[model samples]
Target chain A: MMKELRTAIRAIIVFTIMLGLIYPLAVTVFAQIFFKSQANGSLIVNQDGKIAGSVLIGQSFSSPEYFHPRSSFAGTGYDAIQSSGSCLGPTNKKLVEAVAENLSKVLKENPGVKAKDVPVDAVTASASGLDPHISPEYAELQIPRVAKARSMDVSEVRALVDKYTDGRQIGFLGEPRVNVLLLNLELDRIKKVSNRR
Target chain B: MAGSMWFLLFIYLFTLLVLSIPLGLFMAKVFNREKTFLDFLLVPVENFCYRIFKIDARAEMRWTQYAFALLVFNLVGLVLLYLLQRIQQFLPFNPRHFGAVAPDLAFNTAVSFVTNTNWQAYSGESTMSYLVQMAGLAVQNFLSAATGIAVAIALVRGIVRKETKTIGNFWFDLTRSVLWILLPLSLLIAPLYIWQGVPQNIHAYTDVNTLEGAKQVIAQGPVASQEVIKELGTNGGGFFNANSSHPFENPTPLTNFIQILTIFLISAALCITFGKMSGDKRHGIVLLVSMILLFVTGFFFAYKFEKAGNPQFAALMQRGTVENMEGKEVRFGVLNSSLFAVVTTCTSCGAVNSMHDSFTPLGGLVPLFNIELGEVIFGGVGSGLYGILLYAILSVFIAGLMVGRTPEYLGKKIQSFEVKMVMLGVLISPACMLVLAAIGVVTAGGMAGISNPGPHGLTQVLYAFSSGAGNNGSAFAGLSANTLFYNILMGVDMLIGRFAMLIPVLAVAGSLAEKKKVPMSIGTFPTTGFLFVVLLIGVLLIVGALTFFPAISLGPILDHLQMLKGILY
Candidate 1:
């Protein structure tokens, strides 16, 4: 029994060092060497030399000139430190009221857009409040508002939205999505170039 | 559902089957001490581990010794993990410098991982330091899964070997499970995750100024390494609070698909391993098919309900997408989210890509039902095969009684002792789950943890105990389960759920190992084929439904009815 206990203790220490320390460190070193940007959080740097945000993580985009991501329940909205969902059940009053409010808000923000045109993603909270992508349909719904705000043609804004939209990975795996951050950033870049001219 | 949804499901299952057959055969080869492709490199490592463990690779043990070694190793692991969490502030790699965890939560977390139930009462990013996450929790992820696989392999030996006092060495099996199987798989997959943008760093969380000018702290860690094993080992603890739902952890649709496949891979392969080891691949396929059937049923129900969307939103939205998009990523949408929910629960892998608490009542009930059915639908690695095998034995026993002949399985007689052990193993988990859940609902302390009201609140309480006692770590998440009452009782629930079933399984292993083989005769019930699969599944459903039906009706079923009646809680 004593030998067994001794063996158990030694086993735990050895395995912990091997699996816990050595293995992960090895993987980290390999990742750092090969997949540098991805391993370092996939941060998107703006033209002004400032770290904007991650391409992989979503941030709030409530301005009229930018497309919006999903509704978030992260700290105040998109606080990566407290990534989480609004754990309200399907029958909860909070969820029902929130969705109704969001629908009305969407309709008010975009002129001539009906309730039927708004996608469900426009009114729902993502599992990770940090979800980076908006459904393509949600992105399309915001194009007219973004164009009106920027005084750009609807066709020009729509083309930019199309460029930012990503199809399902490998053509048929997940839902089609648009990276809101990238599209909004491009919108700013295009506005600056046009103003400079 | 779209035709695309059907195609995606087909691809997932086909990839799983194709990958698992080779893996299953390889595992059978490894455990049986046969040569394999990786042996030249891994054998030296295996020898090193055995030397440190002081295990005689040649020395076989009776079931008692095997159980003792496992218990002591796990006990040591439990103590070490608990201490790590308590003293994490003092440790290096604590870039956040988080303080020692509260006593009750620490104890709960320790037991949770040690039992292969990675139930997180506290969120990972805010609570655990890097060292603790790696050395403490991640280590257990590997070991606890190894422990489960070892027990299963031991049980397989019990069925295969005849008139022998010895099964196999626990330390040997444990070492091989980690070094030979879990480690290689994790190593291979970690790079994929890192390439797909799961962070693999020791740096502190990054503070970035967003385009909207608010500061966002992007949590970074040795995530790719841990994330791979988290799914591969069927240990679903997440490094980040939002788990796989966090974009950093599962960046793309391919990563999500890969994660699901990895979660089911080893557990599915083990069925094939059982067949190969027992000299009957057909029986393994039978078990695999039964599990697939159960999984498909649960997935169908969950997907249908989720796709139906929430009725509350049906009034406002007339077109465009109206699926239940709440608490689901746009990248995954309703289909992948629901599929992930069912997969995570059906197996003992409880890593959630979407929050179950926010699911449609019927959608949420599908996962709850899967867990209540013992998670034997491609269940936890070794645990799933042994679980289904126990049902196989019970089925034959029932068959024997019906025909007035002695029950035989794999050419061994099903005696009363075996039946008793089987009954104890099968029934103990649900008994603990239901009884403890009942206590939680009745008591004030338990009532305090509930976040939702009415029948939904009952579900939050029931889901916690069910997740605990089933050794499934997924949660309704809205349940404020960090309190003293939940921590202690659910800790007790997990321990009882894991061991009470485990010891009897070992006892059955011991008993079966000693029994001489009875030659198959005309009267001997065939343990393979359509009839046997039906019988095994029938026994599983009947036992599960009988035990959990009443409590379930009051919870999710009632919640669903209330939702239809426009009752909000």
Candidate 2:
């Protein structure tokens, strides 16, 4: 037992150093060297050279001038103090009422679009409450509203949405969606660049 | 949910099944100690490890010795991890400067990781430091998983070797499993996780302003490296409280699919490894099929219930379309969340892509029931294969009784010692889970953790106990289990749940190793056909249902009935 205990101790220390210290260090170094921007929270920079947000985290876009991300419950909408979901049971009255409230608000924003036409994700709270992307359908639904709000040609804004649309990975892994933060950022860049021209 | 969503579920499972076959073949080669493509990398590293640890690569041990070594090795890890957590305040890379964890929570975490049940009582981003996350948590992710696979290999050796007193060396199995299987696989998967948007850095948390004018501090750390193994190792504790639901941990749908697939990858392949070890691939196929049957059943139920949405909402608002987006990522929807919940629970990889606590009553039932079913539906990493084999033994023993002939499996005559051990292995977790859950409901400390009162609260306690004793780490999240009572009790629950079953399993290995291989005859029961799959599933369900029916009735089932009548709780 004593000898076995010694063996066990030695083996654990060796394995821990190999796995715990070495493995994570190796991966960290790889990420640091190769994927620096993404490794550090994928932080997105604004036109002013200031840290705006991440390419991953969703931000609220209440002014129709920008495309809206999904509704959030992360401490008053995308508060990252505690990343979480609403965790309301499907039948919970709170969830039902919240969705209804969101539905009306979205329809009011997109004038011609009715409640039924509103995308489910547009009205629903996401799991992390920090989802950065919205469905292509949802993005398209808001295109006219966003274009009108920005006083841009619908075709140009539509083209911007198409440009940022990430299709399914490997032809069929996840749903095709557009990154709202990135898309809106691109929209801003497009308008700015065009103005300079 | 649309038809396409249901179709997506099948497509994902089909893809996983197809990938598992080739992966399983590779695993078989690795386990048989045959030459592998990874030998170049493994040989030198493994040889060095064996020499450094003074573990003779060829030396084998009796089943008792093997179990002893496994327990002691794991004990060393538990102590080390606990020490790391206690002293983490003084460690480097703590950008958060998080202090030492409380004693009870720290104790719970140590046992949780060592037992291959990575149940987090506290939120990771809030509680643990980067040093602890990598050194303490990530290290156990590898060791605990290797420990599970080692025991499984030992059991395989015990069955394969006729008239042998010794199984393979614990040290050898542990070393090779990591050197060849785990490390190589993680190398491939971790990089891909980063490519798909999971952050992997030693950087501090980034403070960003949301458009709502609220300050949001995005937590950042060595996420991808820990993540690959968190799923790959079937250790479900997350770096963040939202678990896989968090965008940083599971950035996109592709990453989400990959994460769920990785959880089942090694576990599914282990079945094939078992078959190859026993010299008949059919035995493994049967077990895998039974597991698949249970998984699909659970998946269907969870999906259907979640998709049905809240009927009360339909009535109240007279809405046309109803899809349950509550507690689910709109990105994945009901189908993926349901599939993920079932897979995670069934395999004892308790990583939640969606909150199980928020599922419709019947939808939530499937995962809780999956854990109660002893997690043999593909089980956890190495533990899953061995766990189902325990059920297979029980099934064969029953078949022998039915036919009025002595029971035999893989040409080994069933004996009293083996049966008793199987019984011991089978009953321990359910007994521990139920008794503790019953006690938890009656106690103030335990009840204090229940966020929802009434039946839903009962389930919070029940799921915690089940998750603990079953060595599955997914919690209901409604249960605030960081209190002293829960920490102490569930910590105790994890230990007994893991070892009690493990000791019996090792004993069975010893007993079987001593028996001579009996010849197959006309009256022998065929274990690989359709009937065997049915019987295996039946035995698993019956045992689990019988043991947990009352507790489940008081929890999810009753909660479901209340939901039907628009009762919120």
Candidate 3:
């Protein structure tokens, strides 16, 4: 029994160092050497050389001039450090009410859009409240409002939305969606150019 | 379902079957002590480990010694992990400088990870530091999995070695499993995960200004390294609270597919290993087919219900036109999310690409049902193979009773003692789960953790205990399980669920190891035939369904009926 105890102790410590410390460090070193940008949170930069949010993580976009991301259940909304989901059951009244409230809000924000016209992703909360993409249908629903708010031709904003839209990987995986932050950033850049003109 | 969805499902299963074949053969070679492609590089390191630990490489043991060694090693691991969490604030690599975890949460987490449960009462990125994530949790992710593989190999040894008192050396099996198998696989996959946008650094959370200029703090960590093992080991604990749903943990659709595949890779391959070891490849193939059949059936049920979308939203929008999107990532869509949920739950790999709590009731029930089904559908690594084998024994015993002949499995007679041990092993989880869940549902402390009301609340309580008792780390997430009542109660439940079954399994192995192989006879049932597969699956389903039917009827079944009637809970 004593011999077994000693063996257990030595084995645990040795294995811990090898697996817990050395293995992860080795992987990190390899990642840092080969895929430096991705290994460091995939941060996207602004025109002013400021650190904007990651292209992968979604941010709250409430302004009428910008495209909005999905409704978030993270702390308040889009609290990146505290990632989470609204774990409300499908049949829960709270979820139904929350979806209804979001639907009305979406209808109010975009004039021509009706209840049926709104994409489900617009009103529904994402699993990671930090979901970066919104369905292309949701993005298009907001196009008229974004164009009206920015004092630009609807086609121009539509063109920008089209440019930022990401299709299914290999054309048949995942869903067709738009990155809200990137599209909004592009809108801001084009707005600046038009202002100068 | 769309034709495309059917195509995607076919591709996923086809890929899994194709990939697991070579891996299964390789694993057989690995444990058989035959030379493999990586042996030249890994053999020296393996020897060094044995030397440093002072393990006699040639020394083997009976089942009692193997079980004792495993228990002691796990107990030590549990204590070390608990202390690490308690003092993590004082530990290095804590760039976040988060304070020590609360006592109850720490205790729960320690037992959770050490048992390979990985059930998270507290969210990551907020509570755990980088060091604890790597040293405490991730180490267990490897060791606990290796422990599982060791026991499985021990069982396999017992089956194949005719009339032997000894099974195999626990130390040697543990070392070779980690060094030759888990490590090599992780090293290959970790880089792919990092390249796909999972962060692999120990930097502090970066404060970023959004385009709209709101302050946001992005959490960073050594995620890719842990992510590989988390799936590969079927550990399911995540670096972030959102688990695989967080874009950082599972970035692209390709990565999501890979993560699901990784969860089943070892468990599926072990079937092939079992076949090769049993000296009859057909024996293993029969079990694998039964597992796949169960898996495909569950996936179809889950996908159909999820694609139908939620009923309450029928008036708010077009129902058929829009699938259930609540608590699901847009990138994964409905199909991938449903597929992920089914795969994760069935394999006892609880990492979720979507929130299961918000799944349409019947869709949610599929995962809950899968876990309740003993997770034998290509279950967690080594645990899965051994679990299905237990059912196979039970099936033969029943067949023997039907006819007037002694039951035999792998050519060993199934006596009363063996049958008793099998019963104890099979009954432990459901008994632990249901009894604990009953107490949880009626008690104030457990009820307090429930996030939804009525049947849904019941589902939450049931899911937590089931996941724990099944050694499956996934959760409904809405359950506020960090409370003192839950942490202690579920902690005990998890230990019972793991060791109670494990000890009995080892005992069965020891008993079997002593018996001489029975020869084929006219009355001997062919275990490699289609009838045996049907019987094996039937026994598994009957045990699972009979035990769990009443409880699920009150939970998801009730919830589904209520939803169709436009009732809200």
Candidate 4:
């Protein structure tokens, strides 16, 4: 019995260090070498060299000049620190009210945009509150407002939406979504270039 | 359903069959204590590894000690994983520099991965850092899976041995399983994934101008390694929210075929290993056939249901499409999604290329029903095969009860103690699920988590408990599962559901290990034969149906009836 106990203790210590410590450290080193960008968080930055946000987490873009991501229940909107959706179902009254409020806000911000033009993602929260992209339709809806604000052509903005839209995997897997941060960054660049011109 | 092109499905199935056979054969040989082709190659490497570590490869352990070591090791892993999430901000590689995860959520995640469930209430790309993803979660992915395989191997050792206390050393089995079986297979497959366009990079997220002069941030990660075990171990938790649905993880038809094959490869191989260990290939064949029969049946129904589409949506939208394609990937089509869903559920691989909640009522129920059947249909790594073996024991017992003789499985007599342990393992989840669902429905606190109301809402609650208790981590995504109430309840449910079943399984292993091998007589039932295979299937269905029928009636079954009766409110 004593021998068995001693053996068990030794096994735990050795295996824990080897499997738990060394193996993970080795993998981490390998990952750092091979997948440096991904090993680092996939952070995106703006022109000023300030960190914008990760492509993974959704950011709030409430202005008419930027495309908006899905609705979020994260405290104060798109708070990555508090990553969570509204957790509201289709029939929940709070969900209905929240959707209505978001709709009104979108309509108020972009006057010419029709209510029907709003995408489902624009009003509905993603399962994870930190959805980084909006549907193509949602991106397109912000085009006119963004173009007018940035002094770019609406067609140009529309073309950008087309450019960023990722198609389904191997012709199909998921709905096409345009990353909001990426679009806004481009819009910022276009504005600067046009001003120089 | 457009992607359901018959040719594609055939190709996918054929690839899965071809790859799984060799992988399964190799895994079986590795785990069952036999010399494989890889054994010859891996021996020197194994010796070298042991030498560097200053360890002996020949250390053996009693079955009870083995079980205890595994449990204690994982218990520590659970605590460490939970603590790591809590203190991640202080940890390194956190460029976005996220803060600590909440207590309940952390606890839930810790239990989730440790139990081999890999159910994520939080998104991986955001909630975890590269450090945690690799050092913490991904490491757990390998170790947790190895743990399951070790447990299954221990149980098999128990059954195969006579008058022996030693099941095998936990460390040795775990190391061998990883070094020989999982790592080599993953190394071979990871490159294929990279070649197929799955990302394996450390390059920073690239910024490129869109055609419209818009900049887009492409989310990149160390995907190849994760993708390897994600399929190899049947640990389906994705690094991305979209899981294999994302192009980065699954780039092409070939990658998709590979992913499907990888999910079932280890699971199917374990069955062969069981047969090999028991000295009866037919015994393994019987179990394999039983699993295939159920899986194919479920697959067909999921296909048909999704293809049939929702009639209500069709009339309202004025679209003539006969498939419910909303929330489904157009590339995967209904057929592939249907197959993936069945394969994932059947094997306890929760990786979904499409939204399971968006599946039509019956289609959704198929996966849910698979979980309710206790995930034995080809469960997680080692757990699945052992779970099925438990069912095999039960089948034999029932046969014995009918024939007025002592029951035996793989030469070990299935006696009263074993039967009790098997019963406890089988029934524990249902008891937890049903009781919890009842508590949730009746209590104000429980009902508060419901975001959807009425019958469908009730079904969502039931689904949460079922998913939690069954250790199948896919959620309806229609419920608020992150709240304190859900976190605690589901956390506890997951803990009990996992360990409760596991303890009994281990106990049965210990008991069976002590039993002397019984010689087969003319009157003895041959479990490897077709008749016994059918009997095992019958036992699986009957036990599952009887135990879960009431709960099923209240949830998916009733919901199906409501949909059929046009009773949507």
lDDT of each: 0.90, 0.85, 0.90, 0.71
When 1 and 4 are scored with lDDT, the better candidate is 1
List candidate 4 stretches off by more than 4 Å.
Answer: A1-197, B1-9, B32-59, B201-220, B251-253, B319-322, B564-569
Write candidate 1's Cα lDDT for B187-244 as tens digits: 9999999888998999989989876666788888899999998988788999988999
Error of 1 at B560 (Å): 1.0
Q: Give the CAPRI class of candidate 1.
A: medium
Residue B225 of candidate 4: its Cα lDDT? 69
Q: Write the per-residue lDDT of candidate 2 for residues B1-569, one digit (tens) a residue.
A: 36666567677778877988888888778767888888886799888887788878788799989889888898999999999999999999899989999999999999999998989998888889988999899889998999888888778777888998988888988888898888888988888888777888887888876543456788899999899999999999888888999988998778888988899988898888888878899988999888887888888888888888767545533565466666677567677788889989998789998888788889899999999999998999888988998999999999999888999989999889999999999998899999999999998888898876668888889999999999999988867889999999999999999999888888888889989999999998998799999888888889988988988898888888887777764
Pick out the ten consecutive residues of candidate 4 chain B with the lowest summed lDDT.
Answer: B207-216
- Per-model B-chain TM-score: 0.99, 0.98, 0.99, 0.93
The per-residue C-alpha lDDT of model 2 at residue B92 equals 95
Q: Comparing candidate 2 with candidate 4, which one achieves the higher DockQ? A: 2
Q: How accurate is candidate 1 locally (lDDT)?
A: 0.90
lDDT of 2 by residue, A115-152 (tens): 55666677777877787888888899999998987789
> Comparing 1 and 2 by DockQ, which wins?
1
Better of 1 and 2 by lDDT: 1
User: What are the chain A TM-scores for all the models, listed individually?
Assistant: 0.95, 0.89, 0.94, 0.86
Span of 10 residues, lowest total lDDT, candidate 3 chain B: B314-323
Superposed Cα deviation of residue B496, candidate 2 (Å): 1.6
Question: Which structure is stronger by lDDT: 3 or 4?
Answer: 3
